[model samples]
Target: MKILIKNGMLVTAERTFAADIFVEDGKISRIENPGTLSVSAEKTIDATGLLIFPGGIDPHVHMHLPTPAGFSSDDFYSGSRAALAGGTTTLIDFVTPHRGEPLKEALEKRKAEAASCLTDYAFHMSPVEWRQHLPEEIKACITEEGIPSFKVYMAYKDSIGLEDDALQKVFYAVAEAGGMVTAHCELGDEIEQLRRDYVQNGQTTPEYHPLSRPAELEAGAVEKAIAMAARANCPFYIVHVSAAGSLEFIRQAQQRKQPVFAESCPHYLLLDDSRYKGSFEQTAPYVLSPPLRKKSDNRALWQALSDGTIQSMGTDHCPFMMEQKRNGLHDFRKIANGAGSVEHRLTLLYTYGVLQNKISLNRFVELISTRPAKIFGLYPQKGALLPGADADIVIWNPEKEKTISAQNHMMHCDTDIYEGFKTTGAPEYVLSSGHVVVENGTWKGKAEPGRFLRRKL
Candidate 1:
């Protein structure tokens, strides 16, 4: 299909200017100054007042993730639907293999599970445990599978976290395999001890969730992970960095010209620890990992984002139903450690980050799309507005206004932590691989499986 989008203000990570984009065969064929291209298409969209951007790319999300509380509410189909409605055309989820399973086997199973996705997707293969043969498996994942990133955990020691020794070994394995390591940083032992103490004292409510996993512990883990990555000479990405001290460490690493990237989520930037003070019904939705920090931490993160200490942002969007959360009403540890926000990532960032003058419009594009694309090796094809790039685009109406309510969201989950939050911008139209999947926050096309992208660094 050929589509002509004319008279739109094209925005990217570096430049913002008026241009026309001509998409053909699911790729951008031309980007010319307005009225300069003599192209004819089956469809001509007059985007006179819209801001055209590369479709958003969410690098950290869990669709159909299995947990003690059951699978996260949004499977790939539902989660990708939400992602499309919010202007995201690509998603990078994770493949967490079991303790003894071969990495390729788990990756295949994960690929089958994500066959229902509505947007192009990729994965960060996780090495939950390190075995001698694991190095070969990691090499095969990079050379044969074409996935060059790995996800590691520093918390959840009982399940996925690797001990320091094993963690270092895996880093070396991934480094040898020429893959990057994206980590969930939190000091597992300290957090486990804290949780036990909190539960033993009868403080088994959602309020204790953040108390158990404090910012210091997250920063401590970040420090350790940075050192390990440096030791292994591996490129590292710290996911959902929610602590101010963690930013300091990341900033220092970047200053040393290390291949260390940092990502922060919207909840950590917009919400605070005060959210945990509410009733369980209200607070349970906020019970995510590396829980929301203090307002001071939020400010520090904003500053870090503005100063280039943080390179990207993701939602960490894994959510469950309220009933799922209720399983942890008496035991905070059991609550599914995620919340739904894939559908709100773009609007929230535009309203709060850009409109509030905390970041430039170009910076917003970088945080939401370009930087992540570059980080996960999907750059020009997924996040750039260049010729030969994928025709995944978003026409944004910056003046569009809406109130974020669970009653009107696209995520399969029932709860919304940002409920009632006012948003100032919206995606007027979203195109995935040259197909219009969403228009005016409504789905416009039939459900189709998104292609599995083999990514590289």
Candidate 2:
């Protein structure tokens, strides 16, 4: 099918201009000035007043994640629908294996689980345990599965976290295989001890969640992980970097020209640890790993985003219902560690980052889309609006305004962290692989099942 989008303000990571985009068979075939193409198309969209951009790409999210409390409320179908509604056409979720499970098996299971997704998706293989055959498995993931990114957790010591030795070994293997590793940086041992102390002092509450996993711990873990990755000659990506101190490590590494990238989420940049002081019902929803930081940290993160210290913005969109969050009422340690924001990430960033002048329009595109594609090996095909790129586009109505509310959200989750927050810009139309999935605030739901993206380094 052929589709033509005319008279839109074309915005990309590098430039902004007025042009008409021509898409053929799910890929952008041409870009030209208005009225340049005289041929008729199967469908023509008049984007006279819209800003056309490559669809947003969220590099971190957890859909249908299994937690001790229960599975996350949004599965692939619902989560992808919400993502499309928010102008994100692609997402990268982690494929986490159980402790001691084979990496290949975990990938297969995750693939089956994500089969219902409505937007293009890929996975980051998580190496939960180091084994003799792990290096071979990493190679297979890169060569066979076409997934070039691996992830390791520095927290969750009891289940999914990896110690320094194991992490270093995995980094070495990934480096040798020409792949990168994204680390969840947090000092698990120290945090465990701190949680025990807080409980012993009879000060257990949602507010204590951030107190236990402090900035210093996160910075320390980042420092150690960078050193390990450096020793292994691995390209390292620090995920959900929440502390100002951690940015120092990333900056120093970048100064040395090491292959290191940093990611920060909207929650860490917009919200603060103060939310933890609310009542149990209110505070429980914000209980995520590497919990929200101080206002000073939030300010530093904004500066980092501007200065290129943080390269990408991801949602880490893992949500639990209010009822599920109540499981930890008596003990904050038992709370599910995530909040739902997959559908709000793009709008929030645009409203606060661009409208508030924290970042330029081009920079906003890079943070939410282009940079992630370049870092994760999905460039051109997923993040560019140039000729020959995938026809995943968002027609943004910058003048439109809306208030975020869980009651009206498309995500299956029952709570919205940004509920009642007002935003200026929104997606007027979203096309995934040349298929119109969302148009004028309505979901078309006519696109075929999303394809599994086989990415390369």
Candidate 3:
């Protein structure tokens, strides 16, 4: 298929200028100043009043994740489709192996599940435990599976978290394998004890969720993880940093020239812990791991993002039905620890981050697409708008406005954590690998399977 886009303001991590893009064989064939060249093709789009950018890339998400309540509502197909609708063309979800499961075996199963994705996808392998033979397995993941990044948790200790000793060992092994480690940092023991203490006094409402896992717990874990990664000399990427105190540690690490990278989410940036102040039905949806922080934390995170202390953003888009949240109605600990935002990352960021001048347009592109692609080994191919790059492009209308509502969302989940969050600017058209899958906020019904991106970092 061939397509040509003319008269659009081309925006990249570097600069923005009016240009014409030629696409052929699923890659950008040429880029030139507006009207410099002409090409006749299958499709020609007149982007006279639009902004053109590389499709958004969300580096963290959880599709079809399993928990005691059930699997996250959006599987790969639903989640990826929703992603495209929001101008995201690529996703890097997580692959978490059960206890005693070989990393390779879990990876294979995860790949099979992601085959249904509607947008290109990849994964961050999660190491739940440390074993003597795990170093060999980590190497195999890098060489054989083409997975060069691993996710380790400091929370969820009972099921998926790693102890400090185990986490350090895994960090060393991945560093040796030429891969980086992505960590979910929250003090597991402290949080566990706090939850117990909260429930013991009969305070089991959702409001207690944030109170149980305070900012100090998350910040303490960040300090410890940074130290551990520095000791092992491993490149570390922190996921879903949600606290002002946590940023102090990360900022210091960067000042000292440590190889620590981080990503924050829209919930943390735009919303606050006050969401948990409502009734169970109102507050349960905001109950996620590393619960939301105060507005002061939100302001601090925006500063970090603007100044380069944070490198990227993600949704951690795990979601369950409202009924799934009822499991913890009596005991807040039983509530599933996630909410849906996969389909809103780009819009929310553009609206608040760019339009508000918190970050420049170039920085926005870097945070959402370029930096993630570079860190995860999908750059030039997935995040760039240069000639020879894959044709995952977003034609954005700066004047478009949207009012988010769960009743109108595309994600399969019942609760929209970003419900009623009005957003400005939206994708007018989205092309995934040169295929126009979305036009004017409607799916074009292109069912072509998304290729699993094999990455090596």
- TM for every model, in the order presented, reads 0.99, 0.99, 0.99
User: What is the TM-score (0 to 1) of candidate 3?
Assistant: 0.99
How far off is residue 181 in model 1, in Å?
Answer: 1.0
* Candidate 1 collision pairs: none
Writing each residue's lDDT as its tens digit, candidate 2 over 102-219 gives 8889999999999999999999999999999999999999999999999999988799999888988999999999999999999999999999999889878999999999999999
Pairs that clash in candidate 2: none
Question: For model 1, how big is the CA root-mean-square deviation?
Answer: 0.9
Report the poorest 10 consecutive residues by lDDT, candidate 3.
438-447
User: Candidate 1's residue-wise lDDT over 329-354, tens digit each?
Assistant: 89999888899889999999999999
lDDT of 3 by residue, 74-105 (tens): 99999998999998999999889999899999
TM-score for candidate 2, please give it. Answer: 0.99
Model 1 segments beyond 4 Å from truth?
none
Model 2 CA lDDT for position 397: 93
In order, candidate lDDTs are 0.93, 0.93, 0.92
In candidate 3, position 385 carries an lDDT of 96
